[model samples]
Target chain A: MANNHAGLPSPTLGDLVLPKLYSLFGIANKDSLYGAVAEFEDGPQLVAAGAKVKEAGYTKLDALSPFPVHGIDDAIGVPRSILGFIVICIAFCGTFAAFLLMWYTGAYSGPQIPGCELVGLCSYPLVIGGKPLFHWVFGLPIMFELSILFAAFASVIGMFALNGLPRMHHPTFNYSGIHRATDDRFMLVVEASDPKFKAEETLELLRSLGAVHAELVEDK
Target chain B: MAGHHHDHAVDSYQLDPGKWSTGRNVLAFIALLSWALLGFGYFNDHERFFQSYLVAFCMGTFIILGATFFVYVQYLTGSAWSVPIRRILENIMVSIPIGALLFIPIAFAGVDDLYKWAKPEAISDALIQAKKAFLNVGGFRLRAGILFALWSIWAFAIWTSSTKQDKTKSIEQMKTSSRWAAPGLLVVCLTGCLAAFEWIMSLDPHWYSTIFGLYCMAGGCVAMWATVTLISLGFRSNGVLANTITVEHYHDLGKWMFALSVFWTYLAASQYLLIWYASIPEETIYYKERMHGSWAWVSVLLPIGRFVVPFALLVGRSAKRNLKVLRIAAIWILFMEFVDMYWMIMPNFHEYAHGFHLHWLDLAALGGVFSVYGLVFWSRFKSNSLVVEGDMRFEQGLHFHQV
Candidate 1:
């Protein structure tokens, strides 16, 4: 089952790195650190640094921060979060559910008492105090609640589902520096993912700047 | 940031990470004294419900405990909109024990005025008697204790970890806090419902509402935000919080206030419609009491005053983004929340009291509640870093909250 057919799938990070070079030699000692990995302190500073890094004909960079740093979306050259798209989709389903529930309960399903008026066992809106059923007066609260309830459920459910919540494992934990993620420290670690990644040049670029420390953390 | 340090006359800016301890101490002293006087007056004036004093006491306790736990939660999660003003929330939550302590006599008074379930003779309804498994005094107190304990444990988790993180700066602690929070919030909401049921809703033995729990929560969430925003404004206006809290932050807060205000209205309407449509003998009577017999005016006015008018004021973008508008809207909503609570709770107790009842005790109680909250919140704000300086979000907040 393990080794049935074709050569192993497209290279994971483990395949790309020379473990000995990363471990004993470190970033500066490497022949091509430019594409390997570059580290920065935190998000905003990284974002600021990243924009500059991005401008310097360097298309290969990534960043990690403790909290969301605004503009990082543009700076790091990552596309906008698909979370919102998921949110929109989830919100639609939630709203539909709410509408269906009420429609089913109120209009479709009858505890269906025999009424002075009936829309075929569906609950028809009564003209109470001259307020129209579809009007804002009657419709607003449910619509708003339905939208919000769905959105709320979708937001939490979407965030978890997208992020894979209740998740007990992550590759980032392999990096010791990442431990500072919950605290004051922010970091920008350029991955080997980018095509321009030449490990030596990347390390040179990072060291030339004000980086207090330069080291590689195994993404492998 | 380099060479930007200004030492001119020592422009006094120190992050009083928390204001709760001082606020709690002061509030405790005052609350104990005032509650004592009220307790004495309550004992002398009317023996109808010896436990009635506990109602006021619980309000104070719940406010303090409720508010602080809410604050701890918002911070623990790194909630940015609330980051600037959370210390006050911490203060409010901590002050609950003070209220609990003050309510000791009331708790001791048994079910006298607090609940009809305490007096078994008064509860003839076979159905209500069946619920005694849950609605009993022993069960009620245990739940209350568990609720308070959970809150205290939560508060302490924040207090200990936050203070510990001040020096240690453990990322694990922050993650630990975040991990604990979701469950903690669930527990709090659940306890909050049972607490409301035990402390407020059960005042009338026969009456019950399933949505009552959500109703109380929606009100609590909104009111907590309003009070915190108002206090944040006070701190900002006085140059206390300064750039740490700004209109952008207020904008976000206003959005939440507006969102939750709508939530309250939804819950309120759902509960009303469910009970009204069901038209059951017991359930309909709950609405019947308020929807008619002079209380009807309040029922009518609630939608307009509570939902419609404030909803209108909050809808526009300018109101959310501008501090002046946010403040006005907050104050309006705050007043309305007070009214809304009275509408929900007082109807059960006063029964016949319609419109608004202006009592000196009401004023005193309201003042004590606010003043104690203010004093406690500010003091709590002083004790800890008003912001989670260690938070991954702190730098973003600096940019966001910057004027």
Candidate 2:
């Protein structure tokens, strides 16, 4: 289901001339190159291509497949996620916040003396089962619960944030064979920002490496 | 994970029986020496001997039962990752009969000394007297007999079927285990919980927590994971199954140890929180006895040592992968399980009012029971292939990797 423009007529004068005029006037063009896209038949083929491109000094590489490719992270040099560290920090804050809330309402909000006309307090006081006004032994359950709750929320939100989710589009979508990435094929992209990017050479390299299809994608 | 070879063809699943002959003899000698010491304790300090024996008995018995439960779980879940190590656990599970044999001392001799409900003076207490039918010695013996019989039958059934599959190489054996696993799990859970109530909980006839059985099971399961890890590590160090049971398997075992430790804390907190909030005298009495005097240190140590230390130590992925860290943690967890059992059973002794005291017989009995049980386990373990080669997913287990 690739977008085949082969049957269409060749580009008119504006297609080739407007981009030069646009560049002369410092105006951006939709035809700006985003990346070179390659399609491979399977995960191993894509992983091999990833390793070769990385070895060739292409740092801005990405891959898309219907399933996770096990060694692709190492091949593509993806760093380990720091979401665990983020979640733990949030959990500690939650645990402290829970204890603070309990201490404020259970003990600090009220006067230490037996009787005092305390006013403008957020909470009066609470004493249950002859326990201390704010003993941690009694407060541990709530503290543990809040820590877990905050950690859960942080993981979900942190993962989405770290992944830059909720977006409508990505540069990889500009490839004509992109849709097949989610179905049968594996897609590898070498971004135009990479220092090693030479459109024709990269495309030739991917083709030589056994890509089923290779093409340069535009920003639009 | 580096510098380790994964040449599965080179790995030998056969354990040379003669290789462990020294270990067996040492264990047997220790068992003989400790049994003689325990015999002296039994004749001299009758009550203390039963108390110490019960603690050691529950320690070994619960772990064996937990192994049985674990084996059934692997079958029920159809877990391929545990296939290589399932035989080690099955060997432990099959030693339930030895555990039953060890209980003969407590069942026939120590019942009168151990259980207050078995004593005539317990009938004077209205609350305990009200439960005479189930709490009596006759009923306790009958229930103990049934519990042992059921556990032995199920353990042998699973072990025999799985071992027989080694030669048959049949998928029907897997189906058979999966079929029985459902009912087997139910039977083990019910009977195991009942055994916990009869053996340990009955030590305090007046005080009861519905969560005690689960607490016991959770501790035993953690100890079982630690035991399995230690045994696996032992085999590796002995140059047996060094390649077959790899770091991946050890990592999984470490995860079980950590998860079960947390689960144990959950059950322990559930039991404590309710009684603490309600302030019921009978329920609170159990904690009160342990939480005061010198016992308070142990009560505090239980959570810190068993839950907090292990949780922090093992929570990291790297720590579980590190063999040295995992080894220390397993041994620590095993020690904590014993401390937990000691905390549960020791406070019921008459000397408890005086404060915490570790009797010499406690060591003698522990060494005695564990050594004898170790011999039983070695025999069963050596009789079969160290790994389950017949398992349909054995290769999957061998190649198991966490992404």
Candidate 3:
């Protein structure tokens, strides 16, 4: 069984089922570089290095730290997220949907008979405690709750969507020392796709910015 | 204290007496004019005067309670961001003793005129009769006295401890204030609730909602943050503490104002929804009166003006950080708070219950009470540093930042 799983593994049903399985598996195009990564002593050093890298005209950079380092966003020139706008839009849609649901069930009353020739579908009008059949006052609670529900869902889903999440694997994981980022080390990765990235110059830049060690990351 | 050296855009925390006195004198003038109008309204219409005065009194009382709550919370949380703005809250909190004096007219003179439960004839009603023990004028006055004393003692204890820290710069002063904060918050919350019940809820003796106190406190909380935001903005424009309190602090203040306004709306909705759903006469009558005639306009405007408008205005990151937006939002929230107070109190009066009357006395009494409140706040302002200069977290607050 170990021999069967070892070496260049034999193709299985996944290869036939998922035509792009190799790319999606994050193991593809061997000899292609992902990025150059550097480790730093601490948060401040990482922040300073981020600024230096940005000054060196590298636009595509990411940092990993055990905790949030203040001023990192500004140093790296990160744009503000559009998650709030998305949430509000989704929340308004939720509000409208909630009102529509309540109105159809609690307020709308049309002839139920198929041949009645009415303009709208039949609904059982609920008049509890003598309240009007379709008052926003009564409908407000559900509308408010649904808006929150949708906004909350949007907040989580929108955050993930913006971050391009659900990614099974990441290039940075190829670096053996990456786990130290969760402990004491601070790491910065300059993507190979950056316009200014040249492997030798990038490695030199990282070493100049007080990196304890610098190396290349690979996709496979 | 030794490490408290840093250069900033603004040099001093001391108020320029000449400049601020001009503002105080303007408040004093407004007070005198409004009080004169109140006096005229009193002799002109006895009943209207009490109703309007009660509204103003409740607004001032709630704001003070809110300030007390805000100050104590900061102490308990050991919040570094609030240290720079804590003195403003402390001034507002310490000024709370004046609420006792403000409550005098309501207690001694306006009770029978304002509260249905206080009148001998009203006691004949079964509902009022049942509430007679808690709603009687004597018990009301006694409770008001004790509650005010409790709040004053708590406010002063924390205030003196904090102010002494301005001189002492010792961690012990911080400890003492924090020590008082835990119990002080409980007492304030409880007494504030009872005060709301006894003072405002008893206006409609036949109606009651268990969430009424929280509803009132929520509005006050919103008003308190708005008041703080306005004062801080005012100081910045006047070039005092211009650098000490930054946009980050305003952002936090704006967040508070935004959040509490939503909280106030939540409480309001909870109360209204339960009453509407149950459709019981006694509980529903409160909203019934509010939703009828011209009063209905205010009822509609109350939620939209208080919640929707402010929520939209302050929801964005840029809006909270923008001083112009914050100033507009603060003033609007303060206006809405008064509107809420008016909505709660004015609907109880039978004549005004049928029609929303923006009586001249309403404006006068509001101005009169607020100016007096401002004057007391101004007096405290003169005697202390504009910020908590000696706080252990003063440096942290001075350089506070938010992304």
**lDDT, candidates in the order shown:** 0.62, 0.86, 0.87
> What interface-residue Cα RMSD does candidate 2 give after superposition?
7.1
Regions of model 1 farther than 4 Å from truth: A1-220, B1-40, B47-81, B123-125, B350-356, B369-383, B401-403
* Candidate 2 TM-score, true structure as reference: 0.89
Q: What is the lDDT of residue B132 in candidate 1?
A: 79
User: Stretches of candidate 2 above 4 Å error?
Assistant: A1-33, A51-59, A110-121, A128-131, A194-205, B1-9
Give the per-residue lDDT of model 1 (tens digit) for B1-403: 2212223232123544353454456667776666565555565654323323433444445445446546646656676656545545655665554444444555556455556677656578786688878878787767776776777777667655655565566687677667666777777777778777877788777888988977877777776777778877876765666667666777778877888888888888888767655668888777776775566777787778768776777776666878887888888776776666666666665533444444445544554555554454455556466555565555455446321
How well is each residue in B296-371 modelled by candidate 3, as lDDT tens digits?
A: 9999899899999999999999999999999999999989988888898888888886878888998999998999
Clashes of each: 40, 0, 0
**Once model 1 is optimally superposed onto the true structure by TM-score, how far is the C-alpha of residue B176 displaced, in angstroms?**
3.0
| Model 1: number of backbone collisions | 40
Cα RMSD (Å) between model 3 and the true structure? 6.3
lDDT ranking, best first: 3, 2, 1
Ranking by DockQ: 3, 2, 1
**Candidate 3 segments whose C-alpha is farther than 4 A from its true place:** A1-24, A107-135, B1-10
Q: Which candidate wins on lDDT?
A: 3
lDDT of 3 at A68: 91
Query: What is chain B's TM-score across the candidates, in the order shown?
Result: 0.84, 0.97, 0.97
